[model samples]
Target: MGARIERQKNILDYTLAALLRRKRKNAVLVLVYTLIVFLLASVVFFSRSLQREAADLLQGAPEMIVQRQVAGRHELIPLAYLEKIKKIRGVQAARGRLWGYYYDPVVGANYTLLVPESREVAPGTMAVGEGLARLRLSAVGDDIEFRTHDGSLKELKIARIFPAELGLVSSDLVLVAEEDFRGLFGMPRELVTDLAVQVRNPKELPTIAYKIAEALPDTRQILREEILRTYDAVFNWRGGILIAILSGSVLAFILLAWDKASGMSMEERREIGVLKAIGWETADVIQMKCWEGLAISLTAFLPGVLLAYAHVALTSAGLFEPVLKGWAVLYPHFSIKPYLDVSQVAALFFLAVVPYTVATIIPSWRAAIVDPDAVMR
Candidate 1:
């Protein structure tokens, strides 16, 4: 046991020293590997975050929504429908909500807008998402002037800005008080873009929605699930883009790993053959090379992951949307804290590090088994 332990230690020490000797060259490879791993982790992390956010937003969304079903037009529900919904058996609360898309004329970008300027909103107040707030060069207490598609001019006072996402959609959310919303959009009391319903028992929501639909035949009472289909498409788009960007890095990593292990120098090959000639077993050679791979992966892994965390912390959520990052106070701010699970870390370590280590063993074994005289000749 002592002899075996000594040999393993020797292998580790030599493997580390060998990598250190080529620090400049190996550093470059490690740095690239680190970046690729970071990107991969970030993509996985970001995708997980997106899924959580989408689920939270969709689930927190009204259990049932009543809308006007028209073939090719936006449905405007009556504001008074909230009262009728309250009388339903399982309904806990009901409210009206307004949502629309706004074009940021100053920045030439569009926003998925939510206008909740009702009694629920504080007076003389409006809220905007961090996205629109920065893009428009507006902040808390900044006066925002927006002209609607229908030639309506709204001079909204920015009351407070909140992160629209708490594991939810962080899109362009704007909130204004009901009285101000009327002035801003020229909307009537009977008209609303959507009706939000809350239920006492969430499990009973489907039955309640059906009952509400039957009760209110004139207006359509749709579950939040149906309404979320449009938003689901948006999340898919964001995830796909992130994946495409990171896929390239993974491809590069496979090539780098292959080249590093395959192309051994003449001296290195001779050294390996000599080790074998002097009684180093094939397993020892493989183990030594595996140690090298493990060291590279481990050393790079933590730094790369922390680098990604730092980036997200510095940029905030702006990293997700590269377009508006310019106006971000911190380039990448991590409002959504990453939730680390043992399984994910294990999977990442296996995929990023273990495979490369195994790749290293293949070439090492080939060199170790070669005839020393033949290699020297």
Candidate 2:
């Protein structure tokens, strides 16, 4: 056993020396390999992290949202609908929600206006999200003006700024008094943008949603799980777009790798011939090539993964954030919590590392079995 181990170590050492002999070539190969891994890993890490973030944020979301549909479009829901929904057997509570969007031509972005269900904002004052505050260059105690539906500007003082940690959900959010929201949008006092419903038992959500739909034929029931799924699907679709865009480069890399693996360079062929002539068996030659491939793969993969982790967790994936996040304006500035899935890493390994290793070994095996004189000439 010890003899076998010693022989393997010697082969690995020889592999290292051989790699070092072609420093420039190996360096370039490692760089390209690392870059491919980095790009692929970055996309996976960023998208999955965002998905997790969305899920975590939605955990506290209402079990169901009820919206009124008018001619197949969302319309204001009457407060009267709240009573009907609250009467549903499985419903723990139901309440009308006041919210809408305001377009700020000055900032070239839209702001979400909402009435806080749990707290009251004193009349004539509001709470703004960090992103909105940053865009408007305003802070607490500053007044922000919104163009009311009547072609008039209603100004409100920023009483508070939401904490940056909640930026994912609140980035473009503006919390205002219900009365102010109605006045800004010229909405009737007895109507709301939607209804938020809570349930006693979580499993009965779908049943309750169906009941709500049945009772209010003009209403649409959106469950929390469906919202989560929508977010997941959106991220996945965006990730797919990025992958499609990168496919050309990826294909090129694969072709390069295949060519490199299937056809050994003349120098490499000669080196294998010399080793065979010097009494190294076919298995030993194959083993050395296997070690070389593994060395290069590991050297590339580990750093690539580390770099990707840093890019997402530390830098918030600056390179791919714009495309993946889908927010062109009022882009929320938030850090992605580091998330690693073993399966994802393993998938990346099979895609990036395993093929190259196999390719390296096959060509080396073919060359190893040939007559040394023929190979040398």
Candidate 3:
């Protein structure tokens, strides 16, 4: 009992002495470790946030949407089919919508465009996407003009705004009163684009979309998976690239920290060797290093994670709508109810601190085992 108590005291004493003596150097290692962990955490957090948001976005969309798939190309379906779709059981409200694209001079791209089903009133009152609005500093009632890919200017009054919080799927979204839609396009009311349906029960969604597809032979439906896959095609790919790039920087920092922690100076070697000679053991050495790893991780991770969250918030506030391609509106900003569950934090600790401390232990144990005479020599 006495020996164990003595050893524990020795470990605490040596560890404190080491920390105090190497404050500046140790501080740098801790900071670096913290930063690496922080970046990793942010990556994990953001990826999770993206997946969750994407899933939510898909979940909220019309239980099902149908478009025409012709020879592997999606073509617009006629509005006449909406009545047929409505007659189907489990369908609450079925509305005809037009999906297309528009070019925003401000954002400099052809964004996925949305028009109205009603040809009469849709011209003057347009609903701009929240994302496109931010890009142009536009708001409700602002006059927005865009040329279609075919070189026609369909300038219209902004009626309402759509939020793309989940997908912000596209940056340019313009909805107008349908009466104006006919006049703008110089086309008759016979043409329609897409069908959006709200189902009585979600379980009935796939069956309904499938039924619509069967009835309308030419129409293709946008299922929940399709929308999510689209999001993945865009954001997921981009997010992965970002993660890959950021991972390199994080890796570099981790290595730098590991090297620094492992490479104690001659003075530290001497001090540790003396402590060991005076009866310190491996347990004492490990506890001290574990504490060191804990301290460093906390210092780095807290600030790093906070900074990443801030970055996402600021970026989304400024650019969510402009960058997304579909022209769908998304919520401007949403706070991720971060899964700060114990498991997540614990995983981070296990991967970062535990490995770091384990790595630190190897050198610490070596130093502890050194014969004082040999080390002195």
Candidate 4:
């Protein structure tokens, strides 16, 4: 065992020396390899982080949401629908929800208006999201005006500003009283944006949703799991698009790898020839090449992953944030909690490190199998 370990140590030392001998060439290779790894890691990390954020935010959401459709477009659901939903056997509770969108021309952005069910907002006061507060430069007790549906302006005092940590979901949100919501949108009291439903048993969510659909044919039931799945699909689709766009860079790296595998420089050939001539076996030469490949791969991959983590978890992936997060005027500012999956990193390692190592070994093995005199000539 000691002999084998010592042999490997010597081979690794030689590998490092050989790499340093061709520092310019290996440095360029490492730079390109690191760049490709960085791009791929950025996409993966950003997409996964967004998916996690969506799931975490939706954890406290209603089990099911019922929306009314008119001519294939969403319309205000009548409070009457709440009664119908409550009548469903598996439904534990059902209530009408008031919400809508308002475009603020001053900021050139849209804000979400909602009526809180668990808390109260005074009729003449409202709570605004951090993004809105920042945009309007407004503070608590400050009045902001909204033009009602009848082209009349209504002003409400800012009761509070939501915490910045909730910006992922609450950015551009405005929480108002039910009366205020109805008056501002000119909606009748008998109608609400939708119905939020809770099921008695979590496992019966699907059955409850089907029953709700049967009871209200004009209404669509959205399950919490379905919402989560939609978010996952959207993030995955966006990540796939980004990877596709960066495919050219990946191909370039592969070509560079292929070139390294297919041919060796005259100096490299002579070096290997000399090693074999000096009694080094073919296996030893191949092992040394493997060590060289591993050194370069580690040199590239470690920094790439570290940089990607910082970019996504600390800086919010500023490079690819817009593409992955979607277009929005009031973009939320929040940090993505760092998440690492061993399987994902392992897969990336195999995809990147293993192939290059194998490629390096194959060429060295091919050259090592030949007679030293002939190789030198």
Candidate 5:
């Protein structure tokens, strides 16, 4: 066993020396390969992290959301619908939700206005997200002005700011008292933006949604699962777009590997010939070449993945952020949580390293089988 281990070590040493001998050529190949892996891995890492964040944040969200549509556009629902929804058999609770978009002209950004159900937002104070606070240059106890729907300017003090964890969802969120929300939006007291429904039993969510639809034909009922699926699909679409952008890199790498396999330079052929002429068996020559390829691939793979992790999770994927997360004046400045799964890494490996390894095999064999004396001449 020790002998086998020692022999493998020797082969690895030879691989290292061989790779260093062609450092200039191999360095370019390794750098390009690393960049490709970095781009691909960044997309995977960012998408997966966003998906996990959505799941965690939405865990306690309402089981279903009901909205009213008038003439194919969303309209406020009357409070009367809440009573009807509450009377449904499987429904444990139903409440009217007061929320709307508040477009701030000064900042040129839109903010989500919501009234928290559990707490009473003071009439003259509101809680804002960290992003909104930063944009407004306001903090707790600072006053900000908003142009209301009625062409009136309303001033409110900042009660608090949401923590950073909520940044992704609340980057432009504004929470205020129900009366304040209605006043800012010029909405009548009898109406609300939508309805949040909680069912007594989760298993009957579908049936409850169906019954609500039956009761309120003009209303659209959105199941929580459906909302979650929508988010998942959206992130997946964005991730696909990122992959499409990097597909060029992928193609270039494939071409590089193919060129290496199909056309071995005279120097490479001569090196293989010399190794075989010096009593290195065909198997030994192949092993050495395999090690050389692996050394390059692995050296590129590790740093590529690490850099991608830092890019997505720390720096928020600087260049790709607007592409993947979308561009908005009030876009979230939050970084994704660092999450590196073994399966994802493994998938990347199979996608990248395996192909190069396979491409090297036949060419290495072709070189190894040549007549050493004739090749030398």
Candidate 6:
């Protein structure tokens, strides 16, 4: 066992020296190999992070949300609708929710205003998300001014700011008092943006949603799973598009790899000839070439993935952020918590490292089988 280990050590040392001798050629290969790994890792990490953030928030989300549609557009539902929904057999609770979008022309972004059903904010004060606070340069005790949809300007003092951790969802959120929300959005007291329903048993969620739709013919009932699935689909679709765009680069790299494998330079052929002429067996020659491929593949793969992780988790996914996150009038500004899934990294490995390593095999074997004396001539 020790002798086998020592043999591998000697082979690795020889591989390193051989690769260094052709540093210029191997460097370009490593750079391209690293870039491919980086792109794939970035997409997977960004999409999964968004999905995770959605999942984290979903745990506290209402089991079902009911909204009224008039002429195919969302309209405020009457608060009285909640009374009837609460009477449903499986519904444990039903409450009217207040929320709406406020477009900020100053920043070319939109802000979401909502009133918490269980908590009350003072009439003149509100809570802002970290993103909104940063954009407006407003902090706690500072006032933010907004022009109401009806052409009136209103000011609300910032009572608090949401923690940075919630930025993914709350980056543009503004929590206001119910009365202030109603006033600023021009929503009447009798109406709310939607209805939130909690079911007594999770298994009965579908039944409760069906019953709500039946009771309110013009209403749309959205289950929690539907919302989660929608978010997953959107992120996945966007990620797929970005990956599709990147496929061109990947194709070019594969062509380069194939060219390298099939078109061994005269010098490389001579080097293989020399090795075989010096009492090296065909198996030994193949092992040396395999070591060289592994050295390059693994050296590139590790750092490529690490940099990709930092790009998404720390810097918030630089260039790919817009693509994976999607374009929004008001985008969230939260950094995703770093998460590593072994399966994802393994998939990237098989996609990148395995193919390149395998590509080297055919050429190595071809070179190894040739007559050393004939090749030298």
Which TM-score value belongs to model 2? Answer: 0.94
Looking at model 5, report the run of 10 residues with the lowest lDDT sum. Answer: 257-266
Pairwise lDDT winner, candidates 3 and 6: 6
- TM-score order of candidates, best first? 4, 2, 5, 6, 1, 3
**Global lDDT of each model?**
0.71, 0.90, 0.65, 0.89, 0.87, 0.86
Worst 10 residues of 3 by lDDT: 317-326
lDDT of 2 by residue, 308-369 (tens): 98999889999997799876599777788968999999999888888888889999999899
lDDT score, residue 99, model 2? 84
C-alpha lDDT of residue 359 in model 3: 65
Instruction: Please list the residue runs of candidate 2 whose C-alpha ends up more than 4 Å from where it truly belongs after superposition.
Output: 371-377
Better of 2 and 4 by TM-score: 4
Superposed Cα deviation of residue 228, candidate 3 (Å): 2.6
| Highest-scoring model, TM-score | 4
- Per-model TM-score on C-alpha atoms: 0.75, 0.94, 0.74, 0.96, 0.93, 0.90
Q: What does candidate 6's lDDT look like per residue over 103-216, in tens digits?
A: 899988889888987667899899889889888888899988888769998999999999888888788999899878877878788998899898889999988888888989
lDDT of 3 by residue, 1-377 (tens): 99978866766665566577868976777677666766666655555566667777667577678876779887667778888888888889988776565545666655565554454344467666666677778777787775544577757776667765522454355556655555555545766667788888878888888787777887777777777877767766655666687778878876887786677668767767766666656566567776666556666667766665564555431223233312433333434444344676677667776666666667777776766565456
Candidate 6 wrongly placed segments (more than 4 Å) = 105-108, 145-153, 327-331, 371-377
What is the Å distance of residue 141 in model 4 from its true position? 1.0
Instruction: Tell me how far the alpha carbon of residue 158 in candidate 6 is from the true structure, in angstroms, after superposition.
Output: 2.3
lDDT of 1 by residue, 148-204 (tens): 446877677888776645212444667766666665566777888888778888789
| Per-structure clash totals for the candidates | 11, 0, 32, 0, 0, 0
Candidate closest to the true structure, highest lDDT: 2
- Where is model 1 poorest over a 10-residue stretch in terms of lDDT? 323-332
Runs of candidate 4 with Cα error greater than 4 angstroms are 373-377
Clash pairs (backbone) in predicted model 6: none
Name the candidate, 2 or 5, with the larger TM-score value: 2
* TM-score, model 5 to reference: 0.93
What value of lDDT does candidate 4 attain over all alpha carbons?
A: 0.89
lDDT value, residue 214 of candidate 2: 93
TM-score of model 6 vs. true structure = 0.90
